[model samples]
Target chain A: MNPRLSLNQATIKHADLATALSLTAEAGITSIGLWREPVAEVGLGRAATMVSDSGLRVSSLCRGGFFTASDPAERARALDQNRRAIDEIATLAEAGAPGSAPVLVLVAGGLPAGDRDLASARARAAEAVGDLAADAAGAGVVLAVEPMHPIYAADRGVVSTLREALDLVCDLPAKVAGVVVDTFHVWWDPTLPAQISRAGAEGRIASYQVGDWITPFPGDALLSRGLMGDGHVDFASITRLVLDAGYTGDVEVEIFNQELWDADPAQVVARVVKAFDETVAGQL
Target chain B: MNPRLSLNQATIKHADLATALSLTAEAGITSIGLWREPVAEVGLGRAATMVSDSGLRVSSLCRGGFFTASDPAERARALDQNRRAIDEIATLAEAGAPGSAPVLVLVAGGLPAGDRDLASARARAAEAVGDLAADAAGAGVVLAVEPMHPIYAADRGVVSTLREALDLVCDLPAKVAGVVVDTFHVWWDPTLPAQISRAGAEGRIASYQVGDWITPFPGDALLSRGLMGDGHVDFASITRLVLDAGYTGDVEVEIFNQELWDADPAQVVARVVKAFDETVAGQL
Candidate 1:
């Protein structure tokens, strides 16, 4: 089978939900990764139907977890929002018809206020995931925990390494937990190969996202992602490792850059597709 | 004995070499850490004599390594520069009355040609250090490998963990190889406690530096370090671990902030002294 390629909506931020959907369809890409805010803006039910009619597969939902908050009320709010997101994902999967269940990706939140205690933060994140897993399982949505880079340790995700993510998931049964290995986050890790093998062996490989790293221009951590072949990451080796890890899943191109967003949406998709092809060819 | 505190010259960057010396002496900090460019600006021999006459101990020279270049000519240049740094360190030690040797801190350079091949870069660094170790021993100066943060793995030092630093140093004899544990680079590491014990057991603990983690800033990779208590690092716990590891040396404050650099040099020194006192009292 030809390699499955999915376009994460962030890569085409220049387009609205309708525009992104239409552009993606025109580009002949069969799968997409959707973000929550855009879906909500278009109304989840309407958005689900739009995607359904488009005949595109939903590879994974953008995210669902900000489990690290100091206030109990805030934590409860995050869980409630996540449960609602899971329900929406279940609806979308059903609307998309049989044999099309998109993975629900979880981005475990960073440290709580006045809390530099990483150990406790990690414990809290794992506990939150355990609570969310039951609902996710019932909905037939595979929960994929994406371990973000260490730079995001303070404000994004506490699960910075695949080993750490696997350890967290080990508490739950294999069917309940899996991990998403994003090249942008795990490329710099020294323990990538071993962790990838472990994830695959345990049946915990759920999603595999790709993006390159670009040093942010100071105070812009959230959006400085690089285009493929634009940075120093070894995508060829990483893709080989993921494929070896038994990850026969969609290769999602997820970039968050203002430069790409400002360009034409079709141009961005075409460029990424070309890069993805080159990456597979070992020319990257 | 009261814990002796030292000021790394980078913390008071605005002050000229002579001014920093006078202010540091007046602040009751009898130990100092000097960087190469500043030493070069004010002739190395003259700077050494000035430091000696001020009746202050030179705790460690700031650096002497950038061994990640792949080109033969560039590699030779790096080694030659390191030799000169070693010679200057020897001159400083000799110029000071007998029995006052300073440790030369080494930051093994990052990837060569901007390439991200960590294992190869590490091998190159180890080979270069083996050559420099003999010169360091001959000059009565100990070479201290300072493992930078993992965030710097792509562009700075590949030796991001204390365990990795110790392993790199193991290539040399015990007398010639040692490691510097800086709080800023290592406090977040999960294996820090165990690594500290290992370093102590192997008699490789060379210098102990302190700084905090300021958010949302890159701070010039080598510079832009935070002041203690102003960031997230647990200074007291790390210091205790270092002490437990048989490190009975001066705790040096090394901040590299634009705000602090613009302040009065005397004010910066005073603030550091206060922070050091508070950190020790709070941590102990």
Candidate 2:
């Protein structure tokens, strides 16, 4: 099969879900990753139908899991919300072609209430994931845990390394746990290549996302992502490592650049495709 | 030694060198870390005389290195500049009290222009250090290589890991090379404790700096550092690790906040001292 190309809807967050889907399809990208707000905005039924009609593959749902809260009520609410997100992903999967289910990507929450006890936050995140995994397995959706960068260890996600993420996954049932390898988050990790290999050997490789690294930007919390090749990230090397890790997943371009968002969506898509092509060529 | 406290001059970049010295001494900080630009601005000889008159220990010189340039001319220029910095440091040492010379903190340069070979840049940095080490040793000063954050791997310093920095030191002449453990650059590293121990075992730890991590602000470069306790960094744990690593040096409070810079210098020094006390209390 041809190398699948997935466009994360966040690449065009300014656009509505329909516009993002239509634009992605027009660009000949077969797969897409959706954010929850757009799914809710368009209504899950309509969103699912639109995705089905557009002939676009739902590569993975954007996220589910903000489990680092200190309050028990907040934790329960997060789990409930995750269950709904999983249900929505399942709906999209069933509505799609005969045998494919969209993967649900989970961003385990950072320190709840901005508390700095990273150890406790990590434990809570792991516990939340185990709970979410059962529901995800029942929904027939693979849950991909995306460990964020360390700079976000305070208020975003406690799991900062692929090794840490894999450890968390090990606690959950294999049928419900996998890992998402995003270059933007894990590129600087010295142990990345080894972790990628370990993930592949353990059958935990779920999604491979791509973006570059730009400095002096906002905190590591979500923004500050560079367009592929625009910054210092060595994309080709990371892509090669992930591919070698037995990850045959779509190469999703998930940039969160304010500058790119300001530009024409078509131009942005075209530039990304070109960069992806060059990155692959350079790697091979 | 009373756990000598030094004010890294960048903490008061807004104030002139004389004002910074006066404020630091008045605040009971017995040592000061001087930056090259400020020394240059006030004339190296004058800056040295001022410190001597104030009876302040020059803890570690602010910087010297941008060695990883793609151009040969630029690299040579940097080397020449480092030699001059060494000469200036020698002057500071001669003017300092009887037995001590200020440690020259080396910031190994970032990636060369249009060249993303981090490994190569690191090699060049090591070579530059070797060249400067001879002079530094003869001048009765120690050359301390500071491994910056990985966020600066592209533009500021290629030495991102303490292990990497220690490895580079192995190539230098014995007793001439060491490592600077800066909390702001290394607090996020999972390998920090082990590296610090290794640095101590090898007698290669030269300096230990502290700063916090705050987000939503631009912290890409060496600047943009948060004040101690204001961010998520676990200073107590790190300080213990450093102490365990055999480092009895001053726990310098090095904050790079514009807000603090705008405030009264006396207030800033008082806050730093308070933070230090709290940090030490927690650690003990």
Candidate 3:
């Protein structure tokens, strides 16, 4: 299980809970990564019970971090939602119980509407996430701050690099805050090798996800990710870097191409499993 | 003229040389940047005469850098092309003569066909640009390394940040080499402020191009730029940084939007001049 595969729900966003669970189980993947939307649709309590019954390990919850709003009310609302998300992770589904905390992944949001102060947006994100420390710790959840690719810096997340993300959570406890190293987001970074090593040294690598970099990325850019072997990411090299840095965690595949979404859930799972075995797991 | 304005030819791309010349002159802009393609189309000799006759100082030449082919022959060919481009900058066209050199802005080419080693591609670009130093210096030309946005890291340019570009030309003499600070590209960089300061301190701010960062960028991403006031870039701060850093050069506006391209040439010139006055020149 050197490269234990965990399928992030975003990869198969169109699938329902029962189908997704069955597909992952059938594919022989014992671990999973859930999205809040899908979980809510299935009713959080029932979904938690089902995952517990099926003995599926939820590696992490998909989101929680849009604290860069200018209005006070909006800012407070985002924090409240994140707190709820943290609470959800606490009692959320996991391998053997209905109340095991999954790592909570945090996507630092973009600049507030009509505001161009990137520094302030980032500052607010750091403060808000810091504020959530008490609730996350109380719920026994780890918060992983995800620094998206720089292209997303304008409309999505201001935390555009590992160093920036680490700086944001510099004061937080290691167990309560960390960073997600997704190949899609960070593969282009020249400083990635050194940063990954530093993250490992600091015990800040909460998740090590893999995705490939493809060309002529779609207009949206968000859906530009391809299957591991289908695109150009150097999986062997990146995986080695992570492993060398002491990251012994689930290697999640989170492809977002429209073609993958249109495929039959079982076929998608089989393809993902095979891809993991060859492109990612093979590296391990 | 602390922040003297220069209209890059690309900003009024649809205009022919005659109209482009007349438009810039009519708009009261004494400086203009030219592209090799348009210059070639207008007959280099004639184009040089028109610009010189119109009393427009050529602040810079659009490009010269694609030396990252895996094929030795192709790479050699790119180098030869760049050498020719350097010659073009030195002799093709200018303010008052056919042989006066302007600052040549160079964009590092992306990966060679079927190559995934971005580091190698960047290394190749640096070596190529370094090789051009003697020719650039001999021709009284300066090579400005323009680091495009990270989104262009795949198909267009591998040099994605000012810091990386500076690293590439670190060994070259300041007069023969420098960096291009385009707001559309480096504005998203978290490390931009410090890098710009360093570029200025090192006399590496060869050209400071201004354009706004608009959202829902076009599918091409290349044409996503808008007029100064039409987008979200903070021109005031960026302009201040440039002035503080001892760069008393022309601030060029290089917008590439479909609508702007479709507008009347004179109207486009008027709009650009107005935008510069309001969004950029006003800062001075």
Interface RMSDs of the predictions, in order, are: 2.7, 3.3, 1.4
Please report how far candidate 3 places residue B8 from its true position, in Å: 1.1
- lDDT tens readout by residue for model 2, A1-284: 13477778888878888888888888887778788899899899999899899887777888887888879998899999999999988888777654344678888776655465667788898888888877888888888899887766666777888988999898666668888999888876666788999999888988888888776555533678877777777777788888788877677889998777888888887777787777643553
What docking class should model 1 receive?
A: acceptable
Worst 10 residues of 1 chain A by lDDT: A213-222
lDDT tens digits, residue span B18-89, model 1? 898899889887777778888898898788889788787777787888888989999999999988888887
In order, what lDDT does every prediction score?
Answer: 0.80, 0.79, 0.83
lDDT of 2 by residue, B1-284 (tens): 23466788888788888898899888877777788888888898788889799888777787888888768898889989988888887788667554344578888876666665666777888888887877878776678899887677777888887988898898775467898998888876656778899999998888888888876646444556888877777888888888888886666677888888888888888888788777653553
Off by over 4 Å in 1: A94-101, A215-219, A280-284, B93-101, B218-224
- Structure candidate 3, residue pairs in collision: none
TM per candidate comes to 0.92, 0.90, 0.96
lDDT of 2: 0.79
**Model 2: CAPRI class:** acceptable
Angstrom error of the Cα, residue A80, model 1: value is: 1.9
> What's the TM for model 3?
0.96
What shift in Å separates residue A215 of candidate 3 from its native position after superposition? 1.7
